[model samples]
Target: MKHSEEKEMIRDMARRVAEEQVRPLIASMEESDRFPEELVEIYGDLGLLQMWVPEEYGGPGGDLTSVCLAKEEIGKVSLAASTLCANNSIGLILPLLEFGSEAQKRRYLTESAKGRIVTSVAITEPESGSDVASLRTMARRDGDSYVINGQKSWITFAKQSAYMLVFARTAEGKGYEGISTFIVDCKTPGLKIGKAEHKMGRHGAPSYQVSFEDMRVDADCLLGPEGSGFKSCMRILDLNRPTVGASSLGLAQGAMDQAMRYASDRKQFGKPIAAFQAIQFKIADMAMKIGSARALLYDVAAELDSGDMSRLTLLSSMAKCYCTDVAMEVAIEAVQVHGSYGYSTEYPVERFMRDAKLNQILEGTNEIHRLIIARELFGRR
Candidate 1:
């Protein structure tokens, strides 16, 4: 698979931005647990924020593979900065690009590309967890508007987004059949943004719990069609899962890069740590794991771009689960290679460890992914 010139340019640009801007803000943002608002503006200016959007909708018209390339380069410097791209490509902007109405695209996608607004997706609830069908959010029709009532938890960028793609029950029934999707203005009445969550890492990207009480939107706000929310949800994951996997791939590669540099530069017993066979083995293993994960993730991304959904679901799960696990393992090894400095905030490996842990839990837990893969293997679609 040869890389495109556009993708190469995007990767180089992301790397330069991360090195010059995002990495400089990492320490300050993490200390304050505040999202890096300035860096996001920079990303928007570079068109990285809307790379997932099509050209017709006012974006760079890049594919998932290009987005992954950009993410890997940025993650090498700052995981939180890379997340800004992930949030857009995976579910937020991609969904609208895929299913939004012409009017919706013209307004939302165009503005999103211009950096006029930030967006989020609200699906996970407190009780529902990974059970998308068990969601308790209800949107009752009232004349030309729908009144929504529910709470969404662990919503990425909820506190900062100007709009959110909300999934709620629109009819009385069991499972996913009654669900629907809506694009709600965050300023809508009765929509309350909760406090930013204090997390283990990636503090530069914040998450929150959002409560919708009597939040009302016009009928025009509905995305796709009524009772089609569940299908849209599946489609969203199918499209962006490869990007999630790539995020983990980037984190692992970043940790490996840092560890390798430290090993070659730092000395132990009056000699460079790189000279020790034990340290050499760690570097070798880290490189191998990172390479393997990148291959799997990019293969899946290529399939995504090819419009061949045949085994994408299985491959995406494999990429997300395997790459994230490798990220955690490699990050820990990175810490081990650096000894005490790795455990401290002085080195970014500790942050990498924390961010990599979140990847496994979000975008469907690894346990659930295993179930999906097993189901696919058992001939149960």
Candidate 2:
């Protein structure tokens, strides 16, 4: 598929920023578990956060391909930072575009596009991970307000967000139809944050458990219609999954690049390791896998861009599962090539390995994705 000049320009710009700006500070950010607020502001100024939003709403009105390209570039440097950008771009901004009322869009998208406000989606809970329909959080209607009460776990950027797009149960029915989504200001009354989870990877992006006890939102805060939360959330995930795959592709590419560099420089048996057939095979495999993954991701992005929504669920899930799994494999091989240094914090592979693992688990686990894929193949619901 041919890409526009604008897409190529955005990709180049993002790659330069990732290599020059984000990559240098990744180690420090990982060590301290600090969110890169300064970097985010720079991305905002560059319109990274609002690339997909309509131009009227303070965005460049770019397509999904541009978003994926930017994400891939950033992911190559730091998956945590890429995820932060993705969260705002897809998790927060896209949903608003799809379902937000005109007033809500004017209020949120403008600030989010400008990077003045950070946003995140609250959906996963302690007991509800892939089984989103099983979530127990409730948002009860009361005189022109919904009193939300529940605990949301593993919420990304919960510590730094100004607002969160929350999902909760509003009806007493079974399955996805009972769920609803709301836009809640993070500092609203009766909202409390639990301790940040010490994760295996992506430490630079913190996750938290948020508690909402009688937290109230005006009726206008509702996203889309009642009982449509689960569908809207799934749609957003479908749109975002390719970006996740792109992120995985970036990490794998980084690992491949690092491994090749190490093999060239590191000497063994009086010769550089790159000369050895074993190291050569690893590099070949890494390159091949990353190429295939990138192709799949781009195909999905192209399909979305062309307004081909059929089979999106299957394609997105496949890309998410395949790319992430490949990233994990590439990270391991990269570390193997690095030998002892890979295990140490002195090298970035250890962190890359951690960040790669989360991609398989998030946006629905690989196991759940397989189910979706199988269902599609068999023509099952």
Candidate 3:
């Protein structure tokens, strides 16, 4: 699995950016409990904010693998930065690219590529967590506009976004077919962004509750076909899940890095703990799992780069599920390897461990990913 020079360069660039830019912002972001706004401009300057943008749109046309490679580097330092990067490049942009009309693309996509106009997604609700079809949001068509009414919880970067990909039901139904996706301006009259939720990790990347009360948008704001949003939702996740795997891969790698250093330096009975059989065994297991997850994630990303979707759903779910699991496992082991110091804020393994916990639940929860994987296997068409 040899990588192209371009992809490797993208990965290296991200590493440099993470080390130089992200490290300086982490403490401030953690203290403020908010994503650093300056990064939006910084990443935009590097064209790293949204790697999926194509050359035609004034972007570098970086592919899915490039996105993961960069994310793997950034996630090693901060999942908050990585999460923002993914949201800009994958979560919200993919849907627009896939379904948005040319005019829509011209107005939004170009600015998005530049990181000037950030977009957030609104799909999950309090009641319908993982069940997209069961969502209760409604959008009623008026003369030449649609009025929306709903509340979306756990929406990342909603407060800072210029626009949002809001999913609402256009037809009278509780099923997936009735849903439609719309691009709405955040400053629209009836849209209100709620406070960010208190979370266990990635405090800088906060998830907010967004409420819309008769929020109206022009008819042209409709993305793709009306009544096709649920499908679009699935499509976006299919595009997004692998990057999560890549970020999780970084998380696992970061934790292992801490543990490796700790083991080499920390003394036990008489010498370096790295000399101990138990420590060697732990490091070996971490390497084995991390390598396995990376191979699977890279293979999946490469297939996506080749425009192969025959096994997309199955592999994407596997990559996200397995990689996050490995992250969680490795982070815990990293902590254990550090003994008491691992749990303290002085060492980074504790932060990695906290960050690892959130990866399991983001995008699609691991439980939902399992269901997706099982469904794809059993009901493959």
Off by over 4 Å in 3: none
The total number of steric clashes, by the backbone 3 Å criterion, in model 2 comes to 0
| Residues 1-381, model 2: lDDT tens digits | 367888889989999889888988787788878888887777877877667777897777878788889888898889988887645765568888888888989988787767656777899999998889999999999989999999999988887888898999999766799999898888899888888999889878888999999999999989999999999999999888888888888899888988999899999999999999999999999999998998888888888889988888889898899999999999999999999999988888888888899998988989999998999889955
Question: lDDT score of model 1?
Answer: 0.84
lDDT for each candidate structure: 0.84, 0.87, 0.87
Considering TM-score, where higher is better, how would the candidates rank from best to worst?
3, 2, 1
lDDT minimum window of 10 residues, candidate 3: 84-93
Provide the TM-score for each candidate, comma-separated: 0.96, 0.97, 0.97
lDDT of 3 by residue, 99-215 (tens): 888898877767777766567889989998877888998999999999999999998889988888899999985499999999888899999999889988887888899999989
lDDT of 3: 0.87
Error of 3 at 336 (Å): 0.5
